[model samples]
Target chain A: MKEDYKIERVKERINYIEDVLASVAAGDIDARINSEVEDDLSGIEAAIDLLIDDLTDELKQRKKMQKEVEEKLAKIQEQQKTIFQQQSDLLELSSPVSKVWDNVLILPVIGTLDSQRTQIMMENLLEKIVETGCTISILDITGVPTVDTQVANHLLKTVTAARLLGTECIISGISPAIAQTIVHLGIDLSSINTKATLQDAMIYAMKQNQLSENVKLHSLFADSDENEE
Target chain B: MLQLTTDSNWTELGKYIIKTEHDIVQVRQLIRVHAKEMNMGIIDQTRVTTAVSELLRNMYNYGGGGEVLVETGVVDDKNALIITCADEGSGIEDLDLAMSDGYTSGMGMGYGLPGAKRLVDRFEIKSEKNIGTTVRVMKWR
Candidate 1:
């Protein structure tokens, strides 16, 4: 009968659809198609295939994008590293801040505190004190961000290293959070002098500063060379 | 969703760290741009940036020095991100000890891994003796 033939065709299409889904589940994305075979149910199968194709394309795009991103990121990170190095080098080359009175040295650290900058600060502070023949160093960190255990440690390290150099280091302008963090971390900074402000540290430094007679080569670099010429 | 898989080659030795200093503003700006390009939502962006900053600090400090990688994706209908940090110098001998808070290897305060791990939904760390180390972070939308 004509009705029996139509039902058989519909059943055949359904079987085809089931096979398509199995293929998709197996990760064979290219196995489906949008063919019109004049069956009563092929249309629905076609629609599902189209949808799967769309999702597949989108996934591909995303993967490509992720790959591109990884490449660009690697490049940027590389560039930034060079930048960090150059900055530290520059900091090393520059003069460490100094106090004219008592020949004390002051280094004002502003902005956020990280271990690297702290390390650089310590190095610069020591080198400058040594270069200037100062016995006192003042670190003014009023403009720094809140402290954490790491940052506090760097500060302590700076003080300890300075002491090894036979120099007295003063830390001034401790914010509330910083003080709290130090206490929370239980780091003992008892050895370093503390001041409420830079002005205070400077005043303290002036009183303690005494130049060695050996360092009094008044014209150490002799601009007098030009004068003689 | 983000997944962490071990890979040794990610650590780039012989590469220098170009520090811009506390140029926090500049560093933050670059991170934001990266987040947007990855199609991250505002909250996720903030978290990723913070985690990245923490990792960056580590690389800047104990990394002996190397590069960082951040990858974003979608899995199971969830938007996800994976941030990876690599270091090529002498890797940490005791990862668990290093990850412990306040257990700094140097005179440093040592919050790099712990702080970075805290910022993400999932965290994994892998390091080989004298080879390199990689810290992977994952978060979902």
Candidate 2:
């Protein structure tokens, strides 16, 4: 009868282990087997509980690590986005396209002339020309540090694109270094009008405007005089 | 419009849409972050970013804008950052001539593609006439 009682107790412990295993398989990591039962099954129950605890801890650690990585990545991305935007805004501010006079727009370009900046400069110039309907646009690159062949080509393309829109682009503020670079690169600026300084370009543009106005006035007077005759 | 074979260990860093000239700057920023993650030097970072700027500019101008996928994966047992740009605009009819320096269909400097190719360690371009164009570039760490 005592042996029979032990068998019954062992069967009960086995049943408990099966139930705990079922709970675990159902995604319950908190389930634990009874370890107080006085039998060999007690040792088995203790081992199974220890296994569950280890597995749970491992899973928790993995999840925490994954979350930390995601958060760090997000923070870095946000910081980078803001920095990039700030730099872009600074570039826009540096490449200011302003209408200094009637029918004339001036774009004062400063700093390094990367392809990206040159592209922005081109777009800003084009949009300004369209907005102000300026006939003459002056690109003053006095503050530019250096010019590579690609940068010179970008400038040439900008002038050509502006011409296509019926706006004559005058490139001024050619420093000695830039001139030397242009010569070394064998870039032809003869087809496009260029000036030494921003002041010279402005004066030339004003004079041309005055000349055209005078011609228009003279034609009007000539037509009136002919009518009077 | 473009797809890369998935590796179990590959991780996507970011994805950006190139729709305007300003977006090029954003692409540079994205690349900078990934390059930094890979511990790339300043010069290599600049070179890769310059290539990205040119390629993105081409996407905006010729491809009518598209999307770029940036990811980190193993190439030849070395960690690499791969960038792929795809567009569904009017495709390049003459791929060879288009890739050549001083060839342009619009009011561009005509040096964008060739210059970009020179800047990257690995560059590949595929296009179908009237279909689209896709460019892939990789910088290894």
Candidate 3:
């Protein structure tokens, strides 16, 4: 009778261990089989060992999936950052012209001009001159070091666009080397106002401003004195 | 319209393509100066050199030796720059695994090709088993 009782207990323990394994396979790592050896329950322990082996396989698969998902998310984030940088460069390249002084708008080109940036620059310069009602615009390139044929074409586009808006664009700060390069390339800036330096461009703008102001002031004083007479 | 032209600036990098970690600094400095002299923006310059570093790292680690052809200046009414990198190492066996993130044939954090593509406007690649690999990267101003 005792032998039969022990066998029944062993069977019950084996069932409990099976339940634990099911939970573990369903992704519950905390599940543990609580089976005690009551009068030689070797069968129950052997079954428990089998369960542990299966659980190990399940855990590894889950970990692999997690790692793959994480890697994918990281790559996506890196691509987003790149797209953001390009957009930012695009926005900055577009001129944010505020005011026109003495019928002249000065657009300072700084930083490098990639193809996209160059396209945006040409569009911005043309738009600003028309919007601001300026007849003359000076492109100061002191910050610009050199130009390739492609970049030179963009600059030419800027000049042409400005002319379409009935504004003449002045390109200033032609470093001696750049001037020689332009000459060697056989591209002419003769249609555009070329200045030796930014200082020259600024001086020219100031002179235009003063001359216009003097005329306006003179007319104002003449009208007042005539009224007094 | 895109036009093609040769730039003397290409002469400065010499014959050796960036092939190792030790070479990264020189590659970066040259890229920075070339980009700066070309008037490439601060941010583009940063992305570009960082990308170049990653590419050169792969070349050095895998190929052990290689050459890079760098073209700076504008192309076709656009400020254009192109860098072509090639290496004669034991070529990639499983390109599928190679391109996949985290599936590096070498070590940890395999994010080379993906990162390079992200940094520039255009990126292209050609590779073969037992031959070598070549990557062309371009960024316009």
Candidate 4:
């Protein structure tokens, strides 16, 4: 009779241990076999509980690391966006088209000329010409160090585009090195108006402006004379 | 487009999509940064960047869009930077005419391809009608 009773108690303890294990497997880390009576099964039950504690700690650490990595990635993306914005801002600031005279727009280009910057400068100059209805534009490249065949071609395109828009674009400040480079590259800039310095360009533009005014004045006098008749 | 088959010795630095003009600018900046990191002189850096810029512009204009892969490797026992551009656009019909200076099908002054070739140390181009075009250029540092 005592053996049968012990067998029944052992079976109940085993069933309890199975239930605790099942709960732990289902993500219930709190579940444990809290057997008060010290027996042969007690050692295994205590070991399983310690194992569960370790697993929980490991999962917590993994989650923390994941969160930290996500935060860092977000920060890097933000910084990239800021850097892109600053780059465009610099591009805008670099190409400055200002109205220096009554019918003249001057773009003083500085630094190395890349295709991107040259394209932007052309667009800005075109837009300004349309906005202000300027008759002449001076592209000062005194600060530019060099020009390859591609850059020279871009300049030619800019001049052609401006001419199409009815604005005479004068390329000013062509250093001797740049002039030699253009010739060596076999680029033909002869069709476009080029000046040695910005001062020379300004002088030529002022003269052209005066000539147009004189023509207008002459037309006005002719109209008055015909009206009197 | 054809797949880029890089040799085992080459280490790919990055790949950039060339969809818009702005992307061209960004890629140029990235190339400049990589060239600087490779300890290239300013003039060589400019040449590589400018050559890549011309290639990117051509892809954007003619191919409608493309991708460029930048790789660093040793070529002929010299440290080199390689750029590969691939596009799915209609390919060139004549290789010889396209390579010649002042022969453009588009509004460009016909300097895009030949000018790029002049700027780099080594240049290679392949194209198939209606399929695509791929250009590979290498500059030794």
Query: What TM-score fits each model?
Result: 0.43, 0.51, 0.45, 0.67
C-alpha lDDT (0 to 100) for residue A157 of candidate 4: 84
Q: Rank the candidates by TM-score, best first.
A: 4, 2, 3, 1
Candidate 2, which segments miss by more than 4 Å at Cα? A1-8, A60-96, A109-134, A141-166, A173-190, A196-200, A206-229, B1-141
How does the DockQ of candidate 2 come out?
Answer: 0.09
Relative to the unseen true structure, what is the C-alpha lDDT of residue A138 in candidate 4, on a scale of 0 to 100?
Answer: 95
Q: Name the lDDT value of residue A215 in candidate 3.
A: 95
Q: Candidate 4, after superposition: displacement of residue B84 in Å? A: 4.1
Whose DockQ is greatest here? 4
lDDT per model vs. reference: 0.68, 0.81, 0.69, 0.86
After superposing candidate 1 on the true structure, give the runs of residues whose Cα lies further than 4 Å from its correct spot.
Answer: A1-89, A92-95, A100-104, A110-135, A142-154, A173-191, A194-229, B1-54, B60-93, B101-111, B114-132, B136-141
Write out fnat for all predictions, comma-separated: 0.13, 0.04, 0.00, 0.04
Ranking by DockQ: 4, 1, 2, 3
For model 3, give the RMSD to the true fold: 14.9
Report how far off residue B123 is in candidate 1 (Å). Answer: 5.4
Off by over 4 Å in 3: A1-19, A38-94, A98-101, A114-124, A176-191, A203-229, B1-30, B33-141
Give the DockQ (2 decimals) of all models. 0.09, 0.09, 0.04, 0.22
Tens digits of per-residue lDDT, candidate 4, A1-229, equal 9999999999998899899889988988888887798878889888888988898899889999999999999999999999999988999899999999999999999876667788999999999999999999999988875465556777888888999999999999987645654553346789999999999999999999999999999999999999999
- Relative to the real complex, the DockQ score for model 3 comes to 0.04
- Segments in model 4 whose C-alpha atoms lie over 4 Å from true places: A1-15, A68-95, A108-127, A130-133, A140-158, A172-190, A194-229, B1-23, B30-45, B59-110, B127-133, B139-141
Looking at model 3, what is the TM-score of chain A? 0.58
Show pairs that collide, candidate 1: A81-B17, A81-B18, A82-B18, A83-B18, A83-B19, A84-B18, A84-B19, A85-B19, A150-B109
Model 2 interface CAPRI class: incorrect
